[model samples]
Target: MSGLNIISNTSLTMFILIGIPGLEDANFWIAFLLCFVYLMAILGNCTIVFIIKMESSLHEPMYFFLAMLAALDILLVNSVIPKMLGIFWFDAREISFNACLVQMFCIHSISAMESTILVAMAFDRYVAICNPLRHKSILTSSIVAKIGLVAVIRGAAIMAPLPCLIKRLPYCRATVLSHSYCLHQDVMNFSCADISVNIIYGLIIIISAMGLDSLLIFLSYFLILRAVLRLSWEVRLKAFSTCISHICVVLIFYIPFIGLAMVHRFGKRSSPIIAIVMANVYLLVPPVLNPMVYGIKTKQIRQSIMKAFHRNATRPELFH
Candidate 1:
């Protein structure tokens, strides 16, 4: 395959993706299942975003963060699943090198942005619960917008170098990616050039951006916990209840994320099944569960969703 000069010397063109196993030979059942999950994920995230937008009462900092998360989740899942589904349904899995780079950049950037937003959410909760007197002033609408802008800038700064790093590598072998989408590490591994610098830079970004963000989230929650301890029993319970949804979201995202990183770093490449499963988990699970966790755990969001649905169904003429 390398001997065939299919790709032009100057042009880094189409690359082959080794898609999920069993799909190539499986019947319609597999495709159906994936399609079902994809639809559910899109519908769930969209509904959450709509509920947040329509409900005037949810125009506060916490719900603002939740809406940001829902929007990110929609983008995050769309980045990978559409490509994967294309591979499964139509056997159209080939992605251009440039397309792959774009996908990688979007996925990594959005992931970083989501983590930063979570940190911002934690800070908002801390202020709301621990210092209610100053909550209104501290977490103003302008402040939340600033936090979102910072998240976008931070995400771009962290992931902007990744595509450049991948593109600079010498193409000794025909570019064959082993995943559905262009993951940064997966693409780097296929490079014929030495990847020591790329790996080091990647680690630095992860540790400094995501790792540091996680630490700050923990610290914020720790302070909130201390404050909760100082409060009366009823107040402590109320504060804890408000945070349960965020805590669930944090666990869902970080656990699979850390586990997948560990598996890819240490596990054997021969176990493609494990890699595929872990990749899907990291990409899909958080998006699917995020809206549900927030909707069910937070009374305000639940009521808002119900009210939105009722209004839409009952007052269709008003909406039109």
Candidate 2:
């Protein structure tokens, strides 16, 4: 049959996720390890949320943005890892077309939300550091709420159309995906139809989401540094101290993401597993690390965590 005929005639109802090719013997171990990572991410983020909510001291803009970031990290990881572990542990790889669409949308949109939240957090830090006295007046509760809402809405608005655009194409190629999740690029590779529009739109979204946010974040830090440099040595340390965790998170997010993009575009001859692992790391590491970084670096969070543990430890003895 001609390629054109196949493109015109073929239709698919589902796709099979081929999780980690050529490692069938180690699937169980991989799943076990991934489960641990997922658990850590969930517990850490949830603890951040709980402590922030319980402590009125954390009601400020910086902490509120941190809480939003933790929540976004949870959403981003949960969107992919549950299905991923299922594929590895049970060989449950089949995902219906609509389900795949929903998964793709959620994964990308949550990631976009994360990027925007990071930018928001960076702006918060800039305001706090560069204009300390005006920080409260600038990032009021209403403004913070609006930032969160815009992050979510921007992600949804940009990513919601991607799956639908891909859905309209004819997927005559192999239904097996490279990784354990429904990524936009991976799914697009299976379509036999003309995907120029889809590819262009995907590029546009990436630039608008990650590229733009990353640039703005860097700009915010640059301005913050200029302001911090003029302060006393002790004051400089105090100012930069508040920014360390956020800078760590930004590195954690962007480094792996940039590596993944490089691997995807230029590593065609490289091991497929390299691309897959990088992709997983890009999504998994930030969520898991953000809360830990915050909890350790931010004194209030550590004290709150200790207090929670002490209360829990004493409760059983009191009851007994």
lDDT of each residue in 53-164, candidate 2, tens digit only:
9989789998998999888888888888999898889999999888899999998898888889899999999988888899999999999999999999999999989988
lDDT measured at residue 76 in model 2 versus the true structure, 0 to 100: 81
- Distance from true location, Cα of 121 in model 1, Å: 0.5
Q: Once all C-alphas are superposed, what RMSD does model 2 give against the true structure?
A: 1.8
What is the lDDT for 177 in model 2? 85
Top TM-score model? 2
- Would you list the C-alpha lDDT of every candidate in the order shown? 0.85, 0.88
Error of 2 at 241 (Å): 0.5
Expressed as tens digits, the lDDT of each residue in 1-320 for candidate 1 is: 55544433246676787766765777245667777778878998998888888889999999999889989999988888888778777888799888898999999999999999999999999898888999989999999999999998999888999988888776644677778788898888766657998899888987998899899999999999998998899988998999999999999888888877877788864578888788888888898899889989999989988887787688868766
Q: Candidate 1: lDDT over CA atoms? A: 0.85
Any idea what lDDT model 2 has?
0.88
CA shift at 113, candidate 1, in angstroms?
0.4
Quote model 2's TM-score: 0.95
lDDT (C-alpha) at residue 195 in model 2? 86
